[model samples]
Target: MTHNSIRVHYGKRVVAALFGLAVAWGTPVALAEPVDAANQYLGVWNYDQPDRADATDIATVGQFGINPLTFPQVGTIEFTRGRDGEIIGHTDQGCTWHFRVNGDALDLTSTDQYCFNNVIGSGYNTYSWHVTVRDGREQEVVRANSYLGYGTFDFELTNGKRTRADAAGPGDAARLFTGTWMFDPTNPAYLNNLTSPGYQPKTGAVRIDSNGTGLIARTDDGCTWTLDARGNTAELAPAGQTCARSDGTVTMAFWSMSSDGTHVYTVLNSTDPQLGSYFIGSGSLTRQP
Candidate 1:
């Protein structure tokens, strides 16, 4: 036996021992086995929320609430491994922290999705969302459930409102559009959630002014957008404002004057956010003195 050969043989034994020990640890070996399930649905968990939900919605029942929220209908969360080899999860609703997997618990450190990660963490500082690891088939189910993102449900509408209105108004078609145009409150907003029809318009106003040979418009929502006028009609495109849908589908709007230049008709047509269907929302803007 030579000294160099002995050293080489000792190193090989150390590597084999480490590998065997890792196999005995269980879950890590299970997670690293397929490599496919971990690859798919590994990032960006898109979970949209209304005011109500599974157990999480129990607290906000009577205090007045809203469904299909005004903005950001979808919440995004992602989990990734850090430089220290610890797993971290972050949510778009402003929460981030490291998570650890122990025996039967996945302990998340700081961030909580159900209202626990607050300055007080009072109404929600706790509670339940657990799964069963029944029988000898538990590991198989765990491996398969992560990939079970399939099927659909019947959409029902208990209450819905969308405003729709067609009324008279006044506006000038010349001088590249100048003056204040107020969106009528009676203008109907429409919603068809595959179950019911609704009408409840969003009240807003825009001020249009002439600058050089071009037209410019600003909304009360603090969005400055460019107006390209091609006669009595113009395309209102926001430069870099998220004034519309979260998906940027309704980024621009089209405005046209009634043939007599009495009312400005504004509309936006795009794919529905919730369901991939056609969506068209319109507003009747009357010139305000």
Candidate 2:
């Protein structure tokens, strides 16, 4: 869909933005050290780029015109903790990028001259990458997308690998989040920044379905949601087009779940890349029968 995207204009933050990431194209990952909220994303994430022998090309794609290609252009994403107590994000693609830790999930955006540009109609440009890590130690997914010209181009891949000599019965997801969960009005956790508030916390019920690997959930609203399960905690993100504010403002958010899986802390980080105006909000959620 063509966005009412301006060549250069950013709106203010309303709340807070990936995958559009389903099944990965998976690989064997050596077990990393036990991870926690403080440092769950402290390692290198590699994408399973397709080999030229395995590359596929198409014509009249995303309005960028027909061109020959093999695999999506993406590189490794690394996160390191600074000595002064800060998280740093780096990429091998040579794009100027920055990152944030919203709960256990990592958020990265690069809009530098070398990172993001508009050419959607001029001659499409797309560089998207996605990967999922499973069964080894960290069960996670990383997604990235860019469309420069024409209509949007979409890419998806699926593959699998089992590191354990034998298949384990199920994943932690089964035990952590299943069935229905409802938001608690009181004692809810939320992230609210700025002088005045512009939005309210999400209410109503949230339904979750897990298959031992990850979760697929839907909010009372028409939103597809996903959870990133760390060893003891889980992080939440929008799985598809998120609900918008009454004024048509949009948000990018990350919710943190309590270790017991009973309470969820919410943070709506409203940020505008162009307009430079932003707001933040916080709230809480609890489990239900």
Candidate 3:
């Protein structure tokens, strides 16, 4: 081939290789995965007290007895991992740390030691961040060492109350409460695996007025209840026999919803208390005519 023709062919091959490289690199940049829109930080996160064998062990698990907890002391422990497999955590108290995965949960120890490295040697001071994510949110109750006994430790993630989920007076509370709700009377059973001795699994409906002050709830067994803007813990009383043919009355208190209004949770203290006292419950409800 002529020298000029050889030079031109070589130049063309270089341009083609560069073009292919650009397309290969640019495709991934153009089609990156969408960020997860779920703000896991928004909803309430609860964990039960871990069943520790002793007080010293409890300290190791990082439990301080029944006082107001700080973000570091209490609240969700956000986990962050690095590309190199290093791990870190952020908690409500604004504290950050290196963590190790102990099974399904996290163990937040001092930054000095490594998780896999410590599996065989001397023990160090550390706290357990035993938690589970449910419904895309972390549960507050965590088991520090083992799951055995209960502790008096309970926490609210709203920081110091009046969270966006809290009753923002009548206006906001009403807007949130006004919705169409279908009761899956079986949900609690599904979670706890316990059934009431006499009650059948029946469904129901609830309608909240826009004024944020009225409620009309009906049971599938043919019972109803009406509500007016009244108290913090409103009684979910049955209107009459037509409303509830069942054995006991239903009561609800501390009603609240997430910022997105997609999920609703309440502290329902049933006379029967289906699962137990202080039943923390949730349901899927949406706005409607």
Top-lDDT structure, candidate number: 2
Evaluated with TM-score, which candidate comes out highest? 2
**TM agreement with the true structure for every prediction:** 0.30, 0.34, 0.31
> In candidate 2, which residue ranges exceed 4 Å CA deviation?
1-170, 186-196, 199-201, 236-256, 269-281
lDDT of 3 by residue, 20-107 (tens): 8879888422346874333233332322222223221122222364333222111233456634443565433234556544455444
Local distance difference test values of all predictions, in order: 0.37, 0.39, 0.36
Question: By the TM-score metric, which is better: model 1 or model 3?
Answer: 3
lDDT of 2 by residue, 88-149 (tens): 64543323334445554444333221244211112222232222333333222222233533
- What's the number of clashes in each of the models? 12, 25, 16
Q: Output the worst ten-in-a-row residue range by lDDT, candidate 1.
A: 139-148
Instruction: Provide the lDDT at 32 for model 3.
Output: 66
Rank candidates, lDDT, best first. 2, 1, 3
Tens digits of per-residue lDDT, candidate 1, 89-148, equal 564334554544434433444333234222111223222222112221111000000111
- What is the C-alpha local distance difference test score of candidate 1? 0.37
